[model samples]
Target: MRPRSVRARATLGATAVVATALGAASFALLGILDGNLVRGAQADAERQALATAATAAGGGLEPVLVPGRGIDFLQVVDARGRVLAATPNLSGSPALTPTRPGKPGTVRDTWKRGPVRGGQRHRVVQVTTVTGGGLVTVYAGTSLRQADTADETLKAVLAVVVPLLVLTVALVTWRVTGWALRPVEAIRAEVAEISERDLHRRVPVPRSQDEVARLAVTVNATLDRLEAAGIRQRRFIADASHELRSPITVLRTQLEVARAHPDPALWGELVSGALEDTVRLQDLASDLLLLARLDTSEPPPDTPVDLAGLLREEVRARRGGPVPVEPDLAGEATVRGSTLWLSRLVANLLDNAQRHAERRVVLSLRVDRGRGTAVVEVRDDGPGIPAADRERVFERFTRLDDARSRDEGGTGLGLAIARDIATRLGGTLDALDAPRGARLRATLPLAAD
Candidate 1:
């Protein structure tokens, strides 16, 4: 698009984005603040209701009670919802709300009448308790005037601020876009000449220290990154093609031999072999998809996870096989991460260990509160890894025993995926030296209490 068109589009897009964001944020802020204020009022009223209900249960409540702090009024009602005792201001008045709590816990509601001054609403809380007389309900309430005032004030402020902020953003975006587009013609001409064959070519940097100059610098840096990314992408594609060829070749060769021979006796073995290769291909494809996502996707939102609990579930699921898994899950090891990613991480580690174990896999999860790290250790009694190849095994498709890995349907991306997940989760996976087996341990930052 031309500079004028780009300028217009940039201005409108930025303005729209900012305006929408601010509008939504304003509404959310208003709602959250209003709800919090009302909840605070309700909490205070509920506490007052509980205290008064206890008093009524003890038969110690005064007929004309004094309202608690922030409480507008208090009433002790019987099972029939008849007001037996009330605040002095509400003396001889009937029940404020005919509806009573049907259960044993605190129930809150909003009522506009009964001490709702100046068109304000009131938050009413009811606490039910068993007294000597029978089941009694204590009603307590507070005005929602503060919450209403806060909501109104926020609405007024946002009414003025949102438009002004949006207008400011529009004007600023218009000006900055024009400035950034000043050298777009030269950049366009230069970039148009930079084909895949000559990705190293960069746009001309303007002499002046302006947006165009900075734009030129950024464009040049971007070209550098693109050039590097292109090289890496080509290498990845080549390596992936080479790795994929083995299974395709095996599957194709098996099908061709069976088709040429036409042997009914060998049908089962041929089908089993094809199915095995097909499953390996599937595993490879899934691993590649995961690795690609790990390469480009952002880490998911974090939530507190109990790594010990997660490990326990994984261990339980992987047990009752030829290779039993023993778990020594001890202590609290809570960490913040996507549970899906964490589960995959544990699965990969355990899977790798289980694949390599001769008889059993030992899974250990411990909390290092002194260091604020959660350690998950998986050990297998297999032919131990050499000291020099510990880190090498984490590299993509870096199988030490390629023949064995291929036969066992290993994609060789398990450890790589685990390490990537651990890194994205702000953790580290390492192969540690063991006495008679291979031990791989992952350390993660513990979630805050």
Candidate 2:
């Protein structure tokens, strides 16, 4: 699964996204924080100016103002910019920030270092009114010290908090990613422990139905196949040992007998028998070698082949034996496969049929265009195969009758080799029922356009 890469990419992407979002949000918060603080102070100054203008409109404008709650300075002035009323602290002072608009609306400005108590900074607002005594204006202001202090305090707090939040998110992302990849690590470690000698061992599968769990399952399936192949290999080795020993023992015994007797007349007879056994051993070795090649080698390139022509050639080779062979050669049916191996498959089937036939054997080749396959049928008028043992006959080294002599029984690899070759060519060989005997039918794919 290469879980480290998955984890690294996931953590990096998540951290980058969160960092960008939090950074943007932090900047927006800082910009809004100062303005929000200033808005409150300006709103207070506007309200106080409105109140002073209303008082002057009611015609009882006084120079000395009463104590108020919010504003630090308050003054009422006429249209010509003359101070008509003032706060107690500025009883005789000029209008605060009176250089405002000349209409009956509000004008807001910043009160710089001015003639107020100690010249403190303030947010100033001017409100003008349409009165019978001409246009009158009121000026009111509030200190900026508190709003400025709070804005600075919040900026300092956020400078510390944003980094902490991003760090916390990154830590959480790393831990969660590691947790998700833990199962993959476990699967890798377990598979690493599996050797050829440890083929019986299996990797642990997780309960979750996620990608990692599926990966674990696929690895387990591959291990199962390897284990099964190992078992079959060991079994073949055991069977090969037993089969090889039999002929070698017979050859050794015949030689030993001839050596002890030293009979010139018996020499011919003993030599012939020894030659027959040697041939049998040779054929057995050849069959074993062919089977080994089939098992281990990569598939040979498939070329166009004439199945009917190949069948006729094989039938001709097997003629003049004890059994009279009949050929039913149909029209040309082309298929695609390795010529040597396909010929081996046909020869094996014919050999098997001739050995089992009583008096008659029929070899036929037909092509079924509807099914896109070429079929080869070899029927023998002998004891037919039982339905229960049909599939078992194709297994290597399996003989239905163990007591039968080796000559009649053959090497027990003909049908097995035939089936293996058929399978390698993407075809099937099956023992089917016949009228009076057994029929081995091989179906292979027809060469297409």
Query: Against the true structure, what is each candidate's TM-score?
Result: 0.50, 0.70
Tell me how far the alpha carbon of residue 20 in candidate 1 is from the true structure, in angstroms, after superposition. Answer: 43
lDDT of 1 at 436: 73
lDDT of 2 by residue, 320-398 (tens): 7889789987778989997788898988887777777899889888878999998889899888789999999898888
lDDT per residue (tens digit) for residues 1-449 in model 1: 53348888899889899999998999899989989999999998998999998888888978888988899888888878778899887788888767766666778899876554656788999888988878888889899989988999999999999999999999999898777777887898999899988997889898888877888899999999999988867876777898899889999999999999899999899999999888888888988998898888675558998778888888778768778899998886789997888998888888888788898889998888899999989999999789999999998787888888776767778998999999988889999999977999999999888
In candidate 2, which residue pairs clash?
A: none
Candidate 2: where is the Cα deviation over 4 Å? 1-10, 24-162, 433-436
Q: After superposition, how far is residue 63 of candidate 1 from its true place, in Å?
A: 99
Residue 393 displacement (Å), model 1: 1.5
